[model samples]
Target: MLKPNTLALTVVLALLTALGPLSTDMYLPALPAIAQDLTASAAQTQLTLSLFLFGFAAGQFFYGPISDRVGRKPVLLFGLALFTLASLGCTLAPNIESLIAARFLQALGASGPIVIGRAIVRDLYEGARAGKELSRMASIMGVVPAIAPVLGGLIAPWGGWRMNFVAALLFGAGLATVVALRLPESLARKSAQTLSFLSILRSFRSLLGHRGYRVYVMLSLLAYGGLFAFISGSSFVLQTVYGLGPMAFALSFSFVVVGYIGGTFLAQRLVGPHGLDGTIRIGVACLALGGSLMVVLVASGVASFLAVVGPMALYCMGVGLTMPQAMASALMPFPDRAGTASSLLGICQMSFAAILGIVLGQNLDGSALPLPLTIAATGLMALAVFGLTGRARRG
Candidate 1:
């Protein structure tokens, strides 16, 4: 059993970690409204999301190294403050281009909490214990995606799409207050690393050169690539291909959330007994199975909604199972460079996902083939990379 304060701290960390997903998911239902209201084309409106991801990936490179030199608390506070201000900018933007720019800044600010939160977990724990804590955090944060779209849909009728930004602003403000008042400085000893280009380059090079870190980060990155592929293609596959209504599609999407929650629960229970590598292997197997099943089903001319969503739910579960362990393993070898490690890990995940999203968006062909094929390909790549690199190191 955990203490009350410990539980509260976990919840706070989870919320801090959840800011990115909440920002993205909560605003999804309003995309059409945003485009229509701002007189923007679909591609231009979509740039808001793409730019946000770009900013998110870029911001982590800076935040990680800076947090290592400074402290987690200050960086987190600065991020939350920036996120709040940027959310306000998003809410007040008079045109689509301005909204796109504001969204980019908002994602840049949001990246701080995410990268720092993972580093904070490393500060408190290590190895499988860190994996367990991260699994717990993932379990809690899983609820954000489940609720965000519904909340956005409900609010959009009353106040239009801009209200979504207002909600995000309030969330950022409240979280900032809680963090400012309660969160402790987890980095007990700060790194002597400076904020120079050469220093950052050296730090990144060091992390990238570590074979174990590279393997684990690649595993996580490929897993997220599959997930982002699903996210990018699901709406089209479900609504456009399978003819599901918006409400039905939303409900169907919840299955992935449920599957993720289940996977995290399983990870929390299993990580201690099986260890990080064992847990990750199980996750990879599940991911491969899910992706493979999707490909087979789609290729066999199964056009049912379950054919698409069922395998996706399984893929999401694999993501939940894989992420905590892989993240823990990736950062385990670099205690001194936890912030930098976390940031690089984040950059790879977001960058790959963003690229996958762009590719999937551009290749929509009115069939279920593209989405499932992408998922399967990514899963296979992740498994192959892990087996080759991870096994060689173990041997």
Candidate 2:
């Protein structure tokens, strides 16, 4: 087998971890066009995103344990095939309902890469090394969110919304081919008890019972929640409320992701001197500050594109700093059961974001308040949770 931490392995891992963002970010610029073309309401179109999150959350729960039992490569290949097929299903979807269902199926498959890719990282490293590696992977994966929507916007005007799914299909196929040819099995030890119901239950209980793991997972969840609120609502808010064209909105979205990319790089630098907890403390402060600024801007009747995406860039930067360290901390304690721990953390993060996406969708009223409000709440909540939990642990 190839040596660990090679550039090739890191690239593959980054691509696998990017599946979630690739699936959502690329199609984001198409949401308005989809609603217009399908004769669906904005709320209905947003269901595609929310349901995708739900499916992603549900799939992570199973993919982790099953991969632990059978090994990572086979399960990952299966998921890639499913995702590729589902993307085709999305491209051929005839109506809004069909598109929604296909998006959900695509998410189910996408979750395998996301959850298992993290497990594979855990397989190879731990603690601050794991945090730095994850930051590297995230830094690489960050390009997808930055570029996918621009590509989608470029394609959507000429090829239409369905063409975005065609791009997704091709991406899935190409990634699958690479994995099949170049990637080795990352699971070092296969657990026979991984899939058993009792074993799964015990694993969950043990992971949840760990204080540090629980706190880290919550921190990750809140960080993601703040970021996702922007993901779910930005296209509409930027397009409808702020009069941005598809390309303009795509560029704006990419600008916000630059903040996230910068954060990942910052995490790499800080993880050594500040450590995971210190990095997180610095990061959440950014999250809270950016989020609060967004709320203030909108509440003060300042509803420009910059007003929204500006603060979001800072918030996303915070996410960049927070996620890798939090993930490394949570999964560090469960080296033997990393897959299970990864899945549980994935589920909590996605489930809450999924529900929050739906809430944002329902509350969207052609105003700029809901998106910023939701982001601010999640950011503030994360800061509060970290403070209280960290104090409790100290006490």
Candidate 3:
């Protein structure tokens, strides 16, 4: 059943998943120093990360749909080329504004694999295999992001923060070369007149009509929003307010990610027996518990910056637990529109987080408490939406 190709495909998909993390993590350790050098506020520097995510979210819409029409490899190469060039721009950027603008373009290019690769996997496998494959790829990201900040912290001072972008540029080029040489064209030759925008508009309507799809997308958007906000502000909370150095922070930061890894591993086992509904319930419950702890810490005036260590990990675990089920359900009905479907999901996810990130970044207040409280509030909001979506479907 498990062929070598299946394993190879998993590895490739893992590399694709690596793109987002590679973009985010490598620069994390340098945020504080960059802020000082750029003479910008913590919030302003954070905007650079948030803005890149904004581009990452928006880019998915164009690339995903186009890949459906033209096939995966060519579209992938095109995005990678743009990403590589953008990375060069980032490296050579003369100021904070220039770096931020180039980061947006770089994220636009990097988003190619993240948005399209999910659909490509669907093109190759379906049903339970699809969910399993997705989890396998997510596992790589879970592990990689956990360690990336640590690595970034270690290298950033020695190499300069900009070197991180150069590393990302090189990594993208290397991955593109591997894909160019090794990847087969996976899209089946479909000669059907590619659905027009108006027709795809109807497909969107039909997609919303499906109860499972609506629930899944909304849940993923809410869930991922919380994580993005945390990432957006962790530098300020940990390194600046709490006076942590890069290495200490990365090591402490990863402890939270451990919760996510545990939850996803558990979800993989539980999904088969408990079903999507049950797995999501457990994930949300854990998330709610984590969120409540955050609010409690802040309200009680007992908040140490370290209070984040426990809750953030739990929150990320909930995301890992819920992602496979939500992803599987969203993709289940649209084998034909896998690209379109994934693009839609990507749109909701990034848009949701972008709004939340903008709000959180705007409120940094020179204290660590706001960061955790913002994360807690977003987590609470996500749990509420997750519950409502589930109830709406049942009624």
Which candidate has the highest TM-score of all?
2
How do the residues 1-395 of candidate 2 rate in per-residue lDDT, one tens digit apiece? 44587878888889999988999999999998899999999999999999999999989888888888889899999999999999999999999999999999999999999999999999999779999999999999999999999999999989998898898898899999998888888788888683677887787888889888889999999999989889999999999999999999999999999999999999999999988899999899999999999999988998578999999999999999999999998898787888889999999999999999999999999998999999999999988988889754332
lDDT tens digits by residue: candidate 3, 227-325: 887778787777767778888888877777777778778887887787767777887777777767876775566646657777788888888887777
Clashing pairs in 1: none
Tell me the lDDT of model 3 at 174: 91
lDDT order of candidates, top first: 2, 1, 3
The lDDT values for all models are: 0.86, 0.91, 0.78
Q: Name the regions of candidate 3 deviating beyond 4 angstroms.
A: 1-5, 189-206, 391-395
- Model 1 is weakest, by summed lDDT over 10 consecutive residues, at 1-10
What TM-score would candidate 2 get against the native? Answer: 0.97
When 1 and 3 are scored with TM-score, the better candidate is 1
Ranking according to TM-score, highest score first: 2, 1, 3
Cα miss at 109, model 3 (Å)? 0.8
Instruction: Work out the TM-score per prediction.
Output: 0.94, 0.97, 0.93
What overall lDDT, based on C-alpha atoms, would model 3 receive against the true structure? Answer: 0.78
> What is candidate 1's local distance difference test score?
0.86
Model 3 poorest ten-residue lDDT run = 1-10
